[model samples]
Target: MDITSQKSAEEASGRYCGILAHPTSFPSPYGIGDLGKGAFDFIDFLKKSGQSLWQLLPTGPTGFGNSPYQLFSAFAGQPLLISPDRLRESDLLKKDDFLDIPYFPRDSVDYGAVIKFKTKLLRKAFSNFQKMNNADLCAEYDVFCEKHSFWLEDYTLFMAAKEAHNGIEWLSWEDSLALLSPSGKAAWKAKLASETDYHAFVQFIFYKQWFELKEYANSNGIRIIGDIPIFAALDSADVWACRELFNLDSKGFPVSVAGVPPDYFSTTGQLWGNPLYDWDFHRNDCYSWWISRVRHQLELYDFVRIDHFRGFEAYWSIPFGSTTAENGHWVKGPGKELFLALEKELGRNLPIIAEDLGVITPEVDDLRDSFHFPGMKVLQFAFTDGRDNTLMPHYFKSNCVCYTGTHDNDTTLGWYGGLDTRTQDWVRRYMNTGGSLINWAFIRTALGSVAKYAIIPLQDVLSLGSESRMNTPGTRDGNWVWRYYQKDLSAELASHMKQLTELYGRHPETSVWHEQSGFATLNSRGPQS
Candidate 1:
């Protein structure tokens, strides 16, 4: 697909297949995957596998223990994911500079080492840019910063200030500085002007490299799907810059935080702790902040997957003093009005997928269906309750998107192996196949579903077990660390995926499959309801 050829919501409505793998999972020599060869290679794999979309987690600069959902700036890219190789190609880095870094693990990210080493290298590159400036690059950097200054100015300042303060949270700073008074901000800007400019320089490099990679993917008939977290970190540039948008105290701390109540995933519930949006404040301005956020994301991706989509309908608000998510109340969100504002600003309904997985209410479904955005259905969630579960293939609707597993879940094989015998038996009978080749079986089932888009996590595609899982919810460490080796994207696996996609009529040329072949016929089915 040419970047211009990407289908608008009006252009194509059904049977488009995709894959779920964050760019961080791409194979790379760097401590983590980056916007480099690994990214381009993965795009090639997507094209070869007859896939049209590549869905990724949020690319934001992670905050508070490396969760993408909690980011330093909702608008900025993770600088650590910026490719040093690309920098070298641009003559901003020397080969020897990369060589002296401590050896990094090939299979997982070492966040601490990667952060320290990359920060130092980025500073060096900034210094080099200052010394030997190219007129064209300088012009480009000016244009980039000017174009993004709405958010970039604050983000760059926040990053520079955080570094100056030895990585303390912004709330720990002095009252005037922390609250971002006009004089205080101006004084700080003058004092840290060099560091601020360097941070802006890094962002310019990141965007340039990423846009090139995105161009490569589009030229090869692949659309990039980007993720957007609905909440922002309390210690973020966003909160620091726009305190009125959140439920914060006079001192600029969250009065109430965001989290989910007890659900299938946990007994204590998950205390995300990110500041909740003050929907009334957003409503007063016709959701201008959200409109800008969505517009910015649409600039970077063909499609955006809204994480925790149900939160837009009704969000769980946890008290600021709570240790766990146990004590929280469901608060109304700026539902239809927000989307109306988005549509009015963009002149069309946005292309989005709703992460409507847990504790879904009818209102959530109403909100999703009203906008014609697809809701996700996970196959792993299906087998736990037999074939009749809403997540099962037989229960999927063509407007939905199906996934074998997601970043937060265990790989299919690992999840299956851990199931009790009765549940395993239920799965075997549900698909009418033995558990001998469960991974492929699950893939086949997902592909053959009524869902318009079918996605499989890279771990499930490689049939890897728990250790390869990208994340385990509620855990601080050992998450977002998985990496794939080049060998994992073998010709054999691509061929198999292509065959399954074609067999299920999910190829780009077809819209739906009327013929059911391998999977069992369930209690009632035409198109799943």
Candidate 2:
């Protein structure tokens, strides 16, 4: 491992606990969570709760379905997350911009309204910036554009062209643009230079604000853990700009797509219509694209959790026109060769957490273990099977990260409430606790387990029910809209969480709060209620 990778590994090695909450869940008045006071307040809450980490969902710009995993560009920060207050602070916006702010719900994001409002403000900010004469800021923007031109130039042009074509899919555009012909690219660049620059300007502001927030979190001793999905959406800048890297045909239609086969969960299975990677081509190119992707993610986060990590060893590929994933077949993936190439360029001992869920094979396990990357264990999956279930806390290893539930799963209380009586009884018997306040029971169990890291979703901490769930798999609507209010982060709640965290030896360094709070000693049973 190089110095950077070694430092990251060291940071991730200790026993610690954190809340798993996305930035969008942070409370704000601008109809969405942003890198404003709400975000800084969240970091302060983490510190007061004795947390050293803050795990997040993918921060990329959401595309169709308003899902972060389905992004416009894997390398771009979500413009929606840009704080209007921060813009005003930078003199890019003024107080008049907030005069017509809409009334947004405190508990959920109305994405449609939020998008329209934020888009207008962002455009205004860009226009204000263009009319300004600030040499320092302009120079900084120029540096950012030049530094990221490898992906920025293509991304901006793609966005501009998509806008020009009334937001239709690239394949439906003129053949020259759809195919990304050299002549067509040059002509479009010249024709849409101003619009493309506007998009680039948006990125510059997004990154400037995002990095400031990241730095604040780090300075507060809280490391951010970001997510990176394994597959890119077919309607993404990635597939639109680099066609040869994907399983697309001459007419830019997918030859085969990505999906998993039928399981007990559903008879037809899940058909995720993402274009599969042309692994042979990637390998021949030394996995340059994958390397750049990983490098960019590392820059945006202290540690990255690669979603659907098992796909690295092998993935399920389905025919393009398949209605369901039942007809998909398992195909070999790039495996260690890709990671080896990444390590050669980025460094070894990469700070990666593998989402090793689903039907993982020995090959996948081998690939994950080869790099000593930690796999995840969701506690909610433990009691569903039997005592021998690997997800049980007793079966957990110190090298793994544990969670009560992920963004895809219901809140811990909701999951427990819906469980069959037999399983519910088993859960109570295993944890040796009454069924009341089951969310806290799960949180305590996770923290006390041998897993090196335990992450409890904020909903579980707040004892929220199904309505507060972040997402539900295999569903299209009513997802990724959950938000929390400022009042939800009560001081008493923080104190309770801190007590449990310290009791489990998950707090960083010596616990002055535990000592001052009259705890008998470390790991003592100190007020479990």
Candidate 3:
């Protein structure tokens, strides 16, 4: 189907609602949320809450700072998220494997502890797999390896190299390994074959478990939205395996890096420090690398949201060692040519959402609108100026996606609490509600918007404070670790969400009384036809 036809299909479905929460934030006893029962249960919660979508952060293995945006491999899954329970069921693990479960904090991920515990368990599982020589499972693993070998082989080898060098970055390794000396490469590959295979086996397990969980979500009317960062990490398998696709020096150092210019959030600007793409090279190959990247991500999600969508039109390039993004300048990107190639290869029915936020220029808007991709709007930004209606619900367009607040922002309750008396009073007047229910006030407005889709952070839905914020941009620590207890997804909360969704036409009017929804008929209030 063409883009117009695909968009019409989405519009015909009417407004849909979603919850923004990463899988790591799911409550679990085993240190972090894994692709296990908790994941399935979360899908069930989304269904109960009248949510049709579940948007999550990237699933890739995080690197140095433990940020998902800066991943080890864009194509590999997070091994730490592999479920031990699932492994045990497959006989790849036994109860004894977890006899010394580490003390992981319940409220937030102690990434250090979780990594140690999960790594030990995963290594043991790999050992058991080899000892048992489980032919059927081994065959499945081999098939998975062969299917993804194009990228998986390089990623596994990269991981093995990282381990061999005591977790040092690739470019900093010895001359032979760093420069890819032919003889040294052969010798090192032979030496690290076992370790590399171990990484490959872990990825096989990740996809196995994730496929199951994603199947469960789809079965229950929940679609997953996955994020894809615009830039590749300088220390990533992508930069290593596809060197020509990035602007890197001969020794693998980035020639220039990625970042955003100074804005309301920062004076020096936010320096992301990831390697910038060599758009000319990508275009020379008809964007094959980008097409493959998007294709791989599409397989993992129902809808793939391209982070920093504006970068396609132009990107901010900072000097390699710049301390801040203030010195960066905008450079023209692949723009229409790249996306046009993607559409030709992947078909125009691509289920994509552009995260068209930040200092958006008319060119960025043109690019996003040209492809019929849904741009995003956050309600929290609406009242920044009392007269700014662009962010207001009443001015929202049907082709967009609306949010009360995103993972980058504080929870609605926390944001309201931070505002001065004047701003707080303005918020109250705008929403036409008292200060007591600010969270729901923002949520209701989002659902009531003309935007075809509305998403609320799990924090806002639960009325959490700043302490539960998932991420705070520009900060290095105390982010992406928030976890919510199962107790927080109460029956009352689900019912309230269902009622609001029904009242605002975000959900099917008749579905409110469906026993599966766990809510009685809300006949008193329903959106007019």
What are the clash counts of all predictions, listed in order?
1, 0, 0
Write one digit per residue (lDDT tens) for candidate 2, span 330-356.
998989988889889988888899999
Residue ranges of candidate 3 with Cα displaced over 4 Å: 1-12, 181-184, 508-529
lDDT-better candidate, 1 vs 3: 3
Sort by lDDT, best first: what order? 2, 3, 1
Give one digit per residue, the lDDT tens place, for model 3 in 1-529: 5433453466565789899999898888887888887788888888887788899999999998888899999899999899888899999889888788878888899998998888988999999989996789889998999999989978988899999889989988887777776677678879899999999999999999999898999888888899999888888888887888899888889988998998756788899999998888888888998888888988888888899999999999999998899999999987888889988988875688999888898999999988889999998888775676588887878988999988889999999999999989989998888878688878888887888899999998887899999888889989889988887887767777777777676764442334454335542222211
RMSD of each: 4.6, 2.2, 3.5
lDDT measured at residue 69 in model 2 versus the true structure, 0 to 100: 84
Candidate 1 Cα outliers beyond 4 Å, as residue runs: 1-6, 9-11, 509-529
Give per-model TM-scores. Answer: 0.94, 0.96, 0.94
How far out, in Å, is residue 152 in model 2? 0.4
lDDT of 3: 0.85
Per residue, candidate 1 scores C-alpha lDDT tens digits across 1-529 of: 3222244633365576778888777777768888988988898888887888898999989976788888999999999889988899988988888878788888998888888889888988998899876999899988998999999999999999998998999999988779888888999999999999999999999999989999998888787889999899888999998999999999988889998988767889999999988888999988999988988998898888999999999999999989999999999998888898888887554678899989899999999999888899998888666456777777677888889988899888889989889888988887777777687788888888888888888887777888898888877888998999987888767766666676787766544444553323321111111
- What order do candidates take by TM-score, descending? 2, 3, 1
- Which TM-score value belongs to model 3? 0.94
Candidate 2 clashes between residue pairs 3 or more apart in a chain or in different chains: none
